[model samples]
Target: MRLSLNKDSYEDVNLYFQDEARFGMMNHLGSYLTASGVKPIVTYQHVFKTTYLYGSYSPINGDSFVWEINGVDNKIFEAYLGAFSNYKPKEYKIVVIDNAGFHSTKHIKVPKNIYLLRIPPYNPELNPCEQVWQYIKNRFKNQRFKTMQDLKKWLHEMINEMKAETIKSITGNHHYVNSFITTFKI
Candidate 1:
């Protein structure tokens, strides 16, 4: 399902929530989920390292992208793939992603259970995630930190600080709105 991440929405961040009969979903970061830190200690370089540009500037329709951030790109990639591997039904519907590099990258071990489809190139509107980044980026705008520990700390703190309704406003699935236009029952 397509979603938005406008500053008015979820920021430039993607949270992967999975489900089944139980809706028993585990949330993972789609765009970036840098789960690296110095445990309880903090450092400046760590924070600076994590503060790289996080946007789709010069967003070419087919620009190659990588899940960069430290050395955890592959780890994050497998984590999401694992979602399909572990929980995706043996027979399920299509899964859509942007034409970003990471999603388009070919793998020798593509799973057969679910199809990986990409949103047409240059079509960010088809993916709700564009707005998610805006919301997340806005949350940290005009903010500065000295270390990665601080960046991580503030992110965790700000996330908790976000109002529940606010989150729903951004990522909540409102299929009913579209269904209203269509005659089909969802």
Candidate 2:
């Protein structure tokens, strides 16, 4: 009856990638020029500029949907909920989310089919959908995209490439999900 709708943002920012090389030469005297010491790097024109992307993840079926938004507001939140409804079309879907302003706004119109359940304040780790962001961010870590479109394309590709079983393995190990399954037998 209740499906946990997790809402979060993923941003694309250019930053220096971590040191990937493992092997480095250490001179006996002091230090010498080494191949590993000079690592290849990718530089971008702007580092502070970021592209904001919002999404909702469904832990029940290992499904995720994303959108590029200029700002986060109650209207957009309602629009996303509508999109979620169109995507899944469940009769009584309960979404568990954090206390974000967009999610809890008075102006937002919640669809009759969707019910929202807010988690405790400041507790994001308890949400199983957080795992979805963790997995995606890890996959794109230390990498810089040439453009926002490129980043979006890559994210879409990576998500599409992942199988449902893989998504379940990545995000389905949470206590809440287990409890839901046990109680509902879903």
Which candidate's lDDT is highest? 2
Q: Write the per-residue lDDT of candidate 1 for residues 72-166, one digit (tens) a residue.
A: 23344545455544442342323445654545445534444434556578876655445545565665544556556666566556545655455
Residue pairs with backbone overlap in model 2: 2-94, 3-94, 4-96, 5-95, 5-96
Residue-level lDDT tens digits of model 2 in 1-186: 434433331111010100001111111122235577595443424434444456555555656566655566678778877876665454345567777766765877787556677778898775666666567666665456666667657766876787767666766655757666675566
**CA RMSD of each candidate after superposition:** 14.7, 11.4
Question: What lDDT score goes with residue 139 in model 2?
Answer: 62
**Cα-lDDT of candidate 2:** 0.55
Worst 10 residues of 1 by lDDT: 18-27
| Model 2 weakest 10-residue run by lDDT | 13-22
Please report the TM-score between candidate 2 and the true structure.
0.70
Q: List residue ranges in candidate 1 displaced over 4 A.
A: 1-48, 51-75, 83-94, 108-115, 160-164, 172-186
